[model samples]
Target: MTAPKPRGGDILAIAAQNKVNWSGLDQTCINAIRVLTIDAVQKANSGHCGLPMAMAPVGYLLYTRFMRHNPKNPEWFGRDRFVLSAGHGSMLLYSLLYLTGYDVSLDDIKQFRQLGSKTPGHPEYGVTEGVETTTGPLGQGFGNGVGMAIAAKHLEARFERDKSGLFDHRIFGICSDGDLMEGVASEAASIAGHLGLGNIIYIYDDNHVTIDGHTELSFDEDVCKRFDAYKWHTQVVEDANDLTALSKAIEKAIKETSRPSLIRVRSIIGYGSPHKQGTSAAHSNPLGVEEVKLTKEFYGYPTEPPFFVADDVLAHFHECVERGEDLEHAWNAKFAAYSKKNPAEAAEFQAALATDLPTGWDAELPVFTPKDSLATRVSASQAEAAIGKKVWNLFGGSADLNESTFTDVKDGGDFERGHFEGRNPHFGIREHGMCAILNGIAVHGGFIPYGSSFLCFTDYARPSIRLAAMMELQVVFVFTHDSIGVGEDGPTHEPIEHLSSLRAIPHLTVIRPGDANEAVEAWRTVMTHTHGPVLLALSRQKVPTLDRTKMAPASGVRRGAYVLTESAGRPPEIILIGSGSELSLVVDAKAKLEEKGKSVRVVSMPSENIFEKQDQDYRDSVLPPGIRRRLAVEAGAPMSWYRWVGLDGEIIGMTTFGASGKYEEVMKHFGFSVDNVVERALKLLAR
Candidate 1:
């Protein structure tokens, strides 16, 4: 049986006890987190107050009692990572960060949800010192935590190579009821369990209240049972307010060391406010000024002082700064000893930890000639395989499409329970889960994670990809079957608008490599460019590798767009532009146009994003302002080509969903044919 809910006197007695056994400090810190959340929400007049308010005890226990994180150096490799998967309740994370003596200040908290403030509406990765990943779309953080746990396991597997206890930290996450309800979380949870990621521990805030009303109106499944089905170690803390049970549950979870653990804590939605407590009203929206005052009095807090943080509470939390520094220092010393014993492993470990790859890491990337048969996906796989061999930190997998996507690092061990040394992760068929997991891997550091699936499946994973772009994570996304060439499977599998849609997301580098050599260069660019995630759109059908000797070398793919074949004359009358599968089509048409005495320039524009980043002079030199007459060809949507073709030019592209046919027939059925392109270019030249 669980302890009964404490009455007013019992609560006060618990709070007033200063004895070391039940020292009031823990309660004070917990209450401090609750009050800070309430005050910040009221000030913002727009925020989720219920979760932070209710889960304060669990959050307090995890931060003060369990996690080994350095507030002074948030990037310490040895630190235990904490992800707030229930990111709408960002105040929960912000309050902990501020209380723990991170760079987040009282002023930052005061400016919550304001412009130019570190405390945004959601937990953003780079903007806040302690925020691990950007999460607001419900379950991305939960999936991300799974990725982090997997990364930790991979690190131990690859480097530890023994029963040595170095790199023994875990990943902790605070998730909401809504987080568990999201499909991404379910997908990630199942994989984590299947892989037996013992380092993952998630505390589900089982408030049982959704936005519409009671979860009974919609969500009513035994979450613990569901997790058990997924093969996870599970527990339920009967009371959200019970600190001792929470601590014990977490400690037990840490000891299991075989399966991921899920501790579901039942709690009131809004704890303190008399009117809103345990209701959906408390879930979002701020308590009124009067309700705020009433809530403070109810929690035994001073109503006069808003955002008040107690000194003893502050001191207690600040100890984390010192504790973290000590942990990192000790780990550093151990690493030094480890380095002395195993110099090669130590060097590899340090290099992985550092974001930069070794000099000339891409020196061995394949350079293809025309003789290298239809080689888009195959070439990408070759380049990635070479990278997987050299970089200890390079790790990733496909979303059940490894064979088709060509993303499997050949012979790179498959990551699973009891096999941590493997570099490849089996994310299963969960594209959404796979991408979010990659986000977790990226944010966790020490690894450059990539994920692959059919280009059409980007729809399933767009939310996580958006978060990756928003956080500017260095995740490489390998998307194959860039066009209607997916064939046979018909319209559903073919990606028409995916290219335009992905290109529009800010900070995302979308590169549709045209052939084998461009695919190699695209991977090279992804390694050197660390600002954001790079999306590589590879061809499903074989695209002939344009011989580098006769045309511009594929190395120009890094420039985004390059003049592959120039007109017989200096200033070409017309320019032919293409990306991915269509570049070969453009090249074929360039031959036809050249035969017709039309001086044409063929430009292989792999990445519009990178090309746009080029200086105007460089851009003009490649696309030239003098040539208004241009023909752009792409098997996908023509929206992105408008800028290059100008208002007067034409785009030989798909006008409808592709017909079910062979890849060649599909390309021909759509006007991507050579005759159509030559006919279009002749008209453009005449105009």
Candidate 2:
């Protein structure tokens, strides 16, 4: 094969890069993949066909030879992970899953992009049996692979000391031009290189065709040089069809046990399509019936039967089923032997795999008192350190905000290149990549992953955060400096609407603790949460811890909201609600209101998301139906409080960006003061 002209920098060539002959069976299987992909897109009438057509050889080679995955048991603990980073080319994954004997059937392929089908337009994690993580919004899967690699490294360090090879699986993926162009992927790639995650190996399909036309229309960076600069092992393959070259590249990548690998392969977009071979037309649109027939003729395939699979091809692919079973059986035996020698470690590993917290995992959790006046972020840090000691499976770090976010686990060592045994991972300043990586870690299992940053910076990580909620991963997202309380940093650092915006995402639990004790309870809830992602928006300024002896216990935080102090001798004539740092205002205001001979109730509502999940009777009990004279106070957008506070009620919140000053000054400026709360409640009661 002739080499393409070198782009910007010197091409990093691989060893043993020579022409290796292919048999009829290999060629037939590769074409079967191509044929099935095109047929699926053609039938669906809406999907990308070009990538599958172009990268069939690499996909076939990886599944058939390189990857140690069991088709029969997609969730086999010892199986290697395969991420389809170029999720737009989803047909490539579905076809492979179907062919390799994963639960995906030919009928599933025909149902591509159809409602309720396992084969969605993009690869969804739980929807498909084999898909490792959800991918589609370009570069997310790339970051996810890095996370999986990190998980593998950590697990291997913890459990593979006996050389049982139980946790030594690698992460393989196929990425497209769009993926590399995305900032998330770039950030993830840089970190992967920095950490020297050798278990990750991704093949870049340099087809040069995107939905907008050729990649040259915009992207023209020297990808190999860039990766090399990131400290990754890079290589170039002139032809995607050169299976031998692809094989050798993968072999070299596997042997380079210190750095991640990116093999860039140049190939035609729509490999066999005669008319639109290298153009954007083939990138997303289906190959028309006539053109498909012409493409099939090019592959020496029968044109009459679309989605046809030869007997030899099926026979060849089904081998993975038996091979996978044997692989699992062997690993089971090794695990049994390891268990005999190390029963405690074996049980711990098993418990982690089952996502079961150990006995007394919460035994050491911090319990705060009214005397502990501290920032919620500080309390959260104490809670994490205590939990981190017992729940060894809880692993994560902040995105260059460790000090600010107060997410450091006390004695937990840093997770670095050579020290994968550490539980704390320094995610640098890459919030976008950090959240996506956290999702990857959560999906990989064996760990309850979390990532932190200032609440305002959730904008950088929103896409991944949304996906985490969508996938229903049990991830804890800790965001500190949650409001204008991040004073002097001004509006850019203060998260004015962040709480409301995060609450908008379905299945995402947003918790902003009212005080130190509540912060500890919030962490308790976070550790026990299993359904979906949870975001903890903690305070940068200290909050007076409510005296549980005089008020409702902090355990009420688990129920999401509770009445802190109830009215005496009557049902409340006026109700006061607050969350996070503003809870103090309502507490103070309640005393002032009672002095006016009004029956007042003060409720500390930390998490509206969790409260809404309670049954009607419970919800009504917290915010009584008769009490329309209610006032809600928070240092954030009032949008989220509308449901809790009736139309007759009022909210003390920031309507404009906060000014740079002391936190107290900022709060007073934004009308988040006790006087404001008292005034609002009086007016509502008068009405």
Candidate 3:
């Protein structure tokens, strides 16, 4: 059956017209999104369809009118960011990208929710053009948006001066009830509000329906009131179908320069669905052909058309491209004039846009010798301070652990609402926000960012860490008081599962440096590697520096695992493996083994993630395959060593939490001493 077509009209004419009189141009464009979403899900047989159908107009307005972005240059630094916090509505994002001349194609849209398609079930950061961040796990995108807003403020403060709006851009996000309900969002929203990030605006799709039926079933709270408590500017639109109201609300949001804005736009779930509108059934499964056809008909769309776009609708969207180009051109002209006036600042701006690290950055890393007895956290602080002096773009702060984590750079000023250009940021006691903010800073580019907190509190930062890994961002995480060696802090303050749990993450680099020298090497490794996020787990107590003359050079830390002490003979009968503070115990065990007429090799495996990246030849060179006799020691979980120690090997590590006692007493009680390591090694060797 052929679909009916309507005549052309102006925006006012279209808005005034009733459902029956509505033009095919308007209905076709909206229904195209509905049809493509349903078809894509039907093809892949997996995905949520309700969100795209309900929020199509929101996506349409942002893509066809407001956002200033170039699909051709998705990585354009000046482009506005769009984060889909409700990632289940990925089809909505994919469809918009396809129509807006982004890299996403018709074929990509059709292949949605399928393997190898750029349009994944959820928007992945690097995999898709125009996807600002990888968002799944509710509330993360909210935090990510805060990070982007913070970045915008920082950049504007640093680059935009005297009629040069170099970094004047907004960070917009589409959030849902689920996103707002997550605690991380609350944490991020508080910080964003406290910082007065006026450039960040979020459109809340207040669709009363959720996957488990009405949102009232699980979530029933005044969202506007919650945001208001965070000191954010809030607004409400009674109807999502009212485009004029949305446009006006967005304009108001943009105009506000004192606080972040949250425009609560009440929308019905499955807006066009004939029967499933405002129902949970419309949230995930595809509307059947009959239901979908009825939905199109209800929206005054052609009944049989699929992925069809009217000429006027195409022209309407083309306005966005033209407007964006004009904006970019105006900004470019302004920048040219600014460059003529401020030559040095312009050069710095260009260098930052290029994302180029300073030359000879490694030369600034602080080094330590055997005579030095310093905590790895202290070393990290010194190294970071030295690096910060050379790299002006480096910026970050701690989650109220600046003193304990030693993350504060000397002489760096705090980043405040009026002083975003300052280098240091005090994230207060919010760990989740700090991590999410770091991810934002890294994603914003031109700045190398790091966040710090006690290792035990990584649980609070885990969600952000996962998002950073998903985005493959280069944010550094400084986690101090790495283990039970935190002494009097008790089990609650000591981290046991953190190192292993962090190591389990696919793209995260978890490095637990043994001493001051290794800590310097670890920072160098972090500065050079851009694959993903890096976590530096440091000890609270001071550790003696390893003897480089008798042990492997600190540079070996880059290899992940290296031979710290080699056997004098052809090969050692037993191998001892350790990391961080435990390496000292293994070194002592090695000496004891040699005195007992046994040759032993001591290996330091600081970062299992980096070690795993090493070639088999290098791995075998460090831990020869022939030496089946091995013993692994670490203060944390024993489960992490089974891979390094083969079937016949033994691991001496804590299987449970430590007690409240002195660090030495806890180590002894947990059998983490040199005597236990030597005993375990002898047992393994005898076997």
Q: Return the lDDT, model 1, position 563.
A: 95
Writing each residue's lDDT as its tens digit, candidate 1 over 1-687 gives 122233233332242221123457777788899899999999999899989988888888888889999999998888888988999889999999999989999989989999989999998989999988898899999999999988888888777845566778899998988898899999999999999999988999987788888787878899999999998999988677777778889999999789999999877777777778767888899998998988788677788789998788899999998998898898888888888888988887787778869877877887777888765888888998888778767789999887788787777777767888877788899999999999999988888999999999999999999999999999999998888998888999999999988998999999988888888889899998888999998888888888788888888988999999976655688889998888888899988888888788999888889999999999999988988888889888889889888887788877688877898988888887889889888887776
- Candidate 1 overall Cα lDDT vs. reference? 0.86
Q: What is the lDDT of candidate 2?
A: 0.88
lDDT (tens digit, per residue) of candidate 3 on 1-687: 222221112321232232222344654666677667876776677788878876776787787778888777777777889999999889988888877778887788878877788999899988999898888788888888888888888778877877466787899999999888888888899998888999998999888777888777889899999899988999997666566777889989989989999999776666666567667887888777788777777666666556555666666656666677777777778888988988988888778767677677667777788899988898878888788888777778899878788777677678888888777788989998788878878887877789999999999989899888878888899999988888887899988888888899989999999888899989888887787999999998888898888787989899999999966855788889889988888998888888899998889999999998999999999889998888888888877789999897888877788778898888788897888887877787777
Candidate 2 residue pairs that clash: none
Count of residue pairs whose backbone atoms collide, per candidate: 0, 0, 0
Instruction: Please list the residue runs of candidate 2 whose C-alpha ends up more than 4 Å from where it truly belongs after superposition.
Output: 1-20
Give the clash total for candidate 3: 0
Deviation (Å) of 678 in candidate 3: 1.6
Shift of residue 527 alpha carbon in model 3, Å:
0.4
**How does candidate 3 fare on TM-score?**
0.95
C-alpha TM-scores of all predictions: 0.96, 0.96, 0.95
Winner on lDDT (1 vs 2): 2
Ranking by TM-score: 2, 1, 3
Backbone clashes in model 3, listed as residue pairs: none
